[model samples]
Target: MKKLFTPFMLGSYRLTHRVVMPPLTRMRAGTDGVASPLAATYYSQRATEGGLIIAEASQISQQGQGYPHTPGIYTQNQIAGWKIVTEAVKSQGAIFFLQLWHVGRISHSSFQKDGALPVAPSAIQPAGNAFTSTGQRVSFETPRALELNEIQQIVDDYRRAAENAKQAGFHGIEIHAANGYLLQQFLEDKTNHRNDRYGGSIENRARLLFEVLDAVLEVWPNDRVGVRLSPFNDVGDISDSDPLELYTHVIKVLSARGIGYLHLIEPQVRSGLVEDMNHEAPPSVATLFRPHFSGPLIVSGGFDADTTEQALAAGTADLVAFGRAFIANPDLPKRLELGAPLNVPDKSTIYGGAERGYTDYPRIDEIGVNTSE
Candidate 1:
C-alpha cells in the first residue's frame, strides 16, 4: 500500500503514484471518427495530479478502423477533437498519451472505404463476430492479405498518426500492438502465414512491428513512445505456437531501443484453485518478462488495489493499469488511498452510449448519504 502511493520516474516524467488508466474502448466518438465532446469531461474526471492516462485507441487510418464511433487520428478534425480531450486531462495535471491503433483483420468491409475488405498479414478469417459501422454484429469477414508495398504504406500511416498525436498535444504515444490488432496479427504465427519478408520466421513475422516503431520514432523520440503487448491473452482469437520465444526476443529488442515503457496484458485468471483452472495458467507475464526489459513495466488485467500494491512491492511491475475500476470510480487513486468503497460499473452501458455509464460515475464526496436523521 505504501509503495502504491510513492512517486516514481517513468521515463522522463515523475508520476505521483503507480495507478495508471489504460486505454479502454468506449464507442462514443462521432460518425466522422472524431472524439466526442464528452470525452474531455470523462477523462478529466478520472485524472489526478502527476497520474498517467493513456487515451482510448485511435485508428491511424480509415482502413485501420474496426468498430464504429471509435476515434481516429488520421484526419484533421479527429486530431482537433482529441486536442480538446488532451487539454482537459492536462489541466488536471495528468500526463496523457494517445494509443495509436489499427484493427487489421478484426474489421468488416462496411468499416472500410468503397467496401474494400479488411487487410491483414494473411487472409485467414477469425472465428467470431465483428461490429459493423451501424452497430450490427455480423460474422467476421476473411480479410485481404496485404501486399509488401501496402505494408510499407500502413507503416507510413502510423508515422503520420504519430505526428497527428503530437499536433493534438499528447505527452507521448503508445503503439497498440496488443489485442490481436494489425501489429499483433503480424506477430502471431496463427494469423500471419506469409512466406515473404514479413512472415514465416519469428524475425520476419515481427518485421512490421519494428518498422512501425521505427517510423513512429522519426516523429517522437524513443523515450516518448510505448508499446503494448499481450503475449498470452487471446482477445482477438490470436495465438502463437511459441509465445515465450517470440516475446522474449521482442522484449529484448524493445529494451535495447530504450522505449518509454512496456505495457503487458496479463492472462485472465479464471476462478478456482490452481489445479482447477480451465487451462494450464502460465507464470505471470510480469514475472517472466520483468528481467528481460530494463525500462518501466506496466501490467494490466484483473488487478485490485491489494494485488497492485503487492506487484509494486515485489518489483514485478513498476505500474499497474486499472481499466474497469477507473471507469466506475473517477477518483480511483484517492479512493484507494482512503480505502473507500468503489462504484460498480454498469455492464449494459459500457459502450456506444451517452454519459450514463460514461461520465455519470460520481466521486466519493458526490455520493450523498442521508445522515440527518
Candidate 2:
C-alpha cells in the first residue's frame, strides 16, 4: 500500500503517487457546454502536487454531447472556459488530461444539434436512459448510422479537440473509448452491425479507434496520449461476442504504439453493482493480459486501500484510480496517507448541482477529525 504513494515517472512527467483521479462528469458546465468557474474551483480543490487528474468527459463536438451541460472542447468559448480549469489544476502542480468524448447512440434528439438523431456505428437503440435538458432521464433513441464521410468528420473532431486541449493548457489528452461511448459503440459487435470497412471482422471493429488515435497523435506525442477502455463494461448497451480476443488485439495494437498509459475500468461494475451499491466489486485482475501491453496500466472501479495494495503488489495494475472516493474526499491522497476517515458522498447531488456536494465535502483537517491514531 505504501508503494502506491511512491513517485513514478509517466512519460515526461513524474507523478508523485499512483492515486489517480479518474474523470467524473459533474454536469456543472454551462448550457453552451462551456466549463463554469465552479468547475475550476471544483478541480483545483482536488489537485495534488505531482498527482494525475483526468478531467471529466468533455464532448469533442456539439454532436458529441448526450447529456445536458456537459462541457465541450470545440468552440472558442469552450476552449476559453477550459483554460481556466487547466491553469487551475496546473497551478497546483498536478497534471491534467482532458477526456475527449462523443456519446454516439447513447443520446436522444433533444440533446442533438438541429434536433437530428444521434449517430452511431449502426442504427441501434441502446437499452439505457440519457439525462435530458429538463433534468429528466429519458430512454435512449435509435441512432442514425454514420456514413464513411461522416466517420471521417468525427475523427477530425477528435483531432481538433486534441489540438484545442493543447491550446487550453492541458498537459495531455485522454481518448474516452470506454463505457459504451462513441468509440466503444463502434468497437462492440452488438452495437456495431455495419458491413463497411469499419465493421464485421475484429480488426474492422477497432478501425475507428485507431483512426481517432492517429489523428490525436498528430497534435500530441504518443507518450502524452492515452486511451481508456472497458473490456467487460456492460453499460450503454455494450457487449462483445469474444471480449478476450477483441481486447487482447486492441491491447497489442496500443502496446506497439507506445502510448503513455492505458486506463481500464475493470469488470467489477457488472455483477457487483447489485449486491452492495456502496461497494463496487474489484475489477477482475487483468494480469493475464498484462503481457499484451508494455505501457502503464491504470485500473479503476471500486477499490479500497487493501485491494489497491494487492493490485500493485501483484503487478496487476500500475495505478489505481478513485472516482466516488475522490468526490467525497477532496484530499483523498492525503487522507489515504494518514489513514484518515472519508466523507460519505451525497448521491443526490452527484450529477447537476452546486457546492452542496460538488466542492463542499470537507477535508479531514477542516472538520478536525483524525482516523489515523
**Per-residue lDDT of candidate 2, residues 88-151 (tens digit):** 9999999999999998887778888789999999998877576666678777788899998889
Candidate 1 per-residue lDDT over residues 1-373, each given as its tens digit: 4788899898889999988999989999999999999999999999999999999999999999999899999999999999999999999999999999999998899999899999999999997789899999889999999998888899999999999999999999999998889999999999999999999999999899999999999999887999999887677778898999999999999999999999998876431101112144466888899999999999997898788888998899999898888989999998887777889989788788999999999887787633233
Error of 1 at 343 (Å): 0.6
TM-score of every model versus the real structure: 0.96, 0.95
Name the TM-score of candidate 2: 0.95
lDDT (Cα, 0-100) at 226 in candidate 1: 97
Evaluate all candidate structures by whole-model CA lDDT and list the values in order. 0.90, 0.87
